[model samples]
Target chain A: MTADILLQAVIGGLLMGLIYALVAAGLSLIFGLMDVVNFAHGELLMVAMFATFSLWQLTGLDPLMVLPLVVVLMFALGVAIYHGLIARALTVQFNRGMVQIFVTFGLGIFIRGLAQFFYGGEFRSITGGMVANRTVQMAGIYVPLPQFAASLVCLGAFALLLVISRTEFGRALEATREDRDAVALIGINRDHIFAIGWGLGAATVGIAGVMLATFYYVSPNVGANFATIAYVTVALGGFGSLGGALVAGLLIGEIEALTALVLEPSLKQVGMFVVYLAVVLFRPRGLFGRL
Target chain B: MEAIPDNAITRRRRNELRCALAVLVVLAILPLPISDVYTQNLIILTLFYAGLSQAWNILGGTCGQISLGHAFYFGVGAYTSTMLFTHLGIPPTLGMFAGGAMGGLMALLIGWPCFRLSGHYYVIATFVVGEIGSLLFLNWDWIGGASGLYIPFHGESWINLQFRTAKLPWHYLFLTFAAATWLVAWLIDGSRWGFAWRAVRDDVVAARSLGVSVFRSKMAAAVISGFFTGLGGALYGQFVGYIDPDSMMTGSLSVLISLPAVLGGVGTLWGPVVGAAILIPVRELSSTFLGGSGRGVDLMLYGAMIVLVALARPQGLVSLLALVRGGRNARTA
Candidate 1:
């Protein structure tokens, strides 16, 4: 009986982990390429979730169907933010680190405030036809349909990212990551590449956001939880390592789920953080991360 | 080194003179005649944040260690000192140091492993410390778990630092701590260790080549910062006379500690002080004007301010002040 519960926890966690992978992958890309932490990444996700909530309420559109629109909107916003804000910041490298941090952190809080301002703190979600309240019964175990859809979305997003990065645009981003000056010297638009990287990063969160609304409550504080968890995911997977983020996300999800099953649910997050510590201490490079 | 430019130096000194006088005049007389309990409470809160942020600046603003888990020390200090006062009837004045010591020890223990990692990894380690501390506080039977520990409201004693009256004591005490922290920042600015810290901040490899033990230096910084922050925590708990894990150890508290330093112009002596001066008032205003969602509104406004600040004066108010002072072109090692 214990074994069965543990297996269920693992499976459930892995599914959630895949979604985390989607969230962190874009973050890793931006960090790897431009070295921008995008402290507002989770907020971006929150914004997307809010958007989905609005769209669902108005048009009764399925959150999944709205994913592409959210991605487009977020991508454009990311580009604008990079050009308007981040570009000005790169001028002085001296205090750039703190500047970036405070800038993004402030942006995050501001976004949350905006959500609270407009949304009025009510929890909203995109619950379409069968997926909203329906559960899938598999071998006497019940799994929410939204959870499964979220996982599929996670896998799809990851696959899409893998392809993009392996393609020309991705190669250019990798080149930019290696050295901005060299990339510029080779006549590549490094700034443009960085903007694209940010856009891509934001777009991924858009995808993650809409899916999150399908299964989870969307509110002003929605991103707060994701923000820390993403940090843990990115750290556990190693900074700037996409593959490591993918694996770490799943692992954390599994750990959180299993811990919740055995212990109190609130403590599951605490357990994930402990795992993050242990991973950082013992294997800072992460399981699949490149040195 | 270039020939000591006496004339230019004196001119810069004169520029700083006006600014310093203005600040001193404001600080000296502002507390007087403001017997309004609300203003006193705001002042006390401002100074509390100023002290915490200044202590945080020692490591984060200076070395760029980016500690998001600083509340670990704050929560620990608050809990420990409060526990001693409540359970053992020990005076909090002495118990505060005990809290600081425990916080310092934890920092060393945690920092030892974390300092080995770079950048975001270090941040995650700090976050974990905070969560673990929260977990311990919540689950442990002793010292009041999730329900929280309350310092005695009836105990009106200076030794225990408890008072039944208004916010005057808290205002004065926190202001003193803030002043002391600034004094320490000034001392650090001229110290050999300060030079080493700046070196480590600018270039670790070069500093390492000069025989500066990078790990030891960072660890020292973490401990120093943690110690004062723990003291701030203890004082905060005393003022409120209530301590809880969530209020003390969460990221919200972490943001409160770090924001002032960032807003004030990090890596400078007066950065946190300026941050507290500017940001806290805005927060209070937003809270009053906005209401119910005042906290949320403040966050949005604060965020917009940060983005604007980053875009325009990324170095913050102190750096801008330094520029206006016409200090010889800012130099970085």
Candidate 2:
């Protein structure tokens, strides 16, 4: 009897884990390249969700249809945030390290405030979307339609990342991560590569946001939830490792889902936080962290 | 070692004594003239923040370990005292110290594993741990769970720390803590432990080579910081007469506590007080005037201020004061 509940939880967690992986991948990539933890990353996802929600309200386009627009817009915004704020902070000379951390955090607050200011503090949810209220039955189990679409999008993001890595830009980004000074010597522009990485990292939130619009509620503070989860994922997965984020994201999802299955649903977050603490305490570099 | 001239040292000490006295006079008298509950509460809240931020400043400013989870300690302060008072019928006056001890112990437990990380990793770890603590508190039904524990208010009594009319008692209590926090920080600025903390903060590798135990110093800073902050929390909970996990132990509270130190100056003794002095009034005013529909405006301003400080003047507003004073006084010296 409990087998059905267990199977459902496992399948549900697996589906969710992939999306978590997608959300965290950008943060991992950004840390991987720049060592700059994008503290405002979850805000970017929040912005993307709002963009998709607004598109639905105004133009009558579903989140799936508005995904491209949100992605492109978020990418541009991410680029601007970096060059405008982060770049300025880096040039401060003496206390660059502390300044770098707080700049993103400050930006995070500012963005959340902007969202609240413009949209008001009310929680908004999309009324109808491409993948709403539909599910598929497989072997006496049902799969939510939007979540299925979300998993597909997650896969697409990974494939796209794979494709991107083979490109010159990815190589430049990798080089920059390896040695910023050496890359500067090689005639490949460090600024462009880093900015693009930042932009792409932000753009991935678009994929996450559009999916979340189908299933979750949207508010200014919603970003804080995803932001913390993403940070935990990045930390658990090993800072700066995309593949690790993917695996760790799934593992966290599984733990969370399994904990909910066995224990109270309210305490589900305990599982991942404990795991994250263990990771930070014992193997901070994480399982697949680079030597 | 270079020795200071007797006259010069006395002159500086006299000037410092005068400044402290002037501040003391102002704080002592501010609530006297203002009988309005709103203004009194604002002063108490602002001072509360000042103390909390200074507590944060110990680890954050002195050791350069930015913890986004001090709220966990704050919540612990509130919860620990509330539990002791509610379960054992012990007065909050005595419960305050016990709560502080709990906070210190919690800080040690949290910081022991956390100090291993530095920079971004450390921040993330602290953040996770804070959330973990908060989640555990929220789920545990033994401590009143999500509804939060409420401290019963009695007729105006010193032991109960409750008042029927005047807010002066609470204001004085808060002022005392803030002043104590400032004084402790001032003392630590000259102590060997303080030197060790600053040494480790400035350069851990160099500090280690200089025979400083980076771990021990950070642990001490965190413990003391949490202990004092927990005391402030007990005062805050008693002053407010209610306690909740979400309200006390959340990221927003963490950010609120740290913002003052960030805006004022991370490493300075009086930065938290000065930062709170400047920002809290603005926050209070914004929330009062534009707060109804324009919610998040205060937060937006805070965010902007943080970004402004980080990008423009990482030295903090206290440095600006110092710059002005030094600029003017340079001619005399």
Candidate 1 clash pair list: A106-B303, A110-B300
TM-score of each prediction:
0.93, 0.95
lDDT tens digits, residues B33-57, model 1? Answer: 8988877778778887888899999
> In model 1, which regions exceed 4 Å deviation?
B3-28, B293-295, B327-333
Candidate 1 global CA lDDT score: 0.81
* Model 2 alpha-carbon drift over 4 Å, by segment: B1-18
Reference-based TM-score, model 2: 0.95
Give lDDT tens digits, candidate 1, residues A1-291: 487877778878987888888888878878777667888888898999889889888888777778899889989988887887777777765578777776777788888888888887777766674478778888887778888888898898888988998898888888888888999888899889888888888898888888888889888888877877888898888778888899889888988887898777657787888878887788876665556
Chain B TM, every candidate? 0.90, 0.94
- Which ten contiguous residues of candidate 1 chain A have the minimum total lDDT? A122-131
Q: List the global CA lDDT of all models.
A: 0.81, 0.85
lDDT of 2 by residue, A1-291 (tens): 389999999989888888888889988888888778888888888998888888999999878989888889989987898789877876786457667777888888888888998898889998697688889898999999888889889889988998888888778878898998798787988888878888999898778888888778889988888888888888888877878988998998898899897678888888888888887678867756664
> Considering summed lDDT, which 10 consecutive residues are worst modelled in model 2 chain A?
A90-99
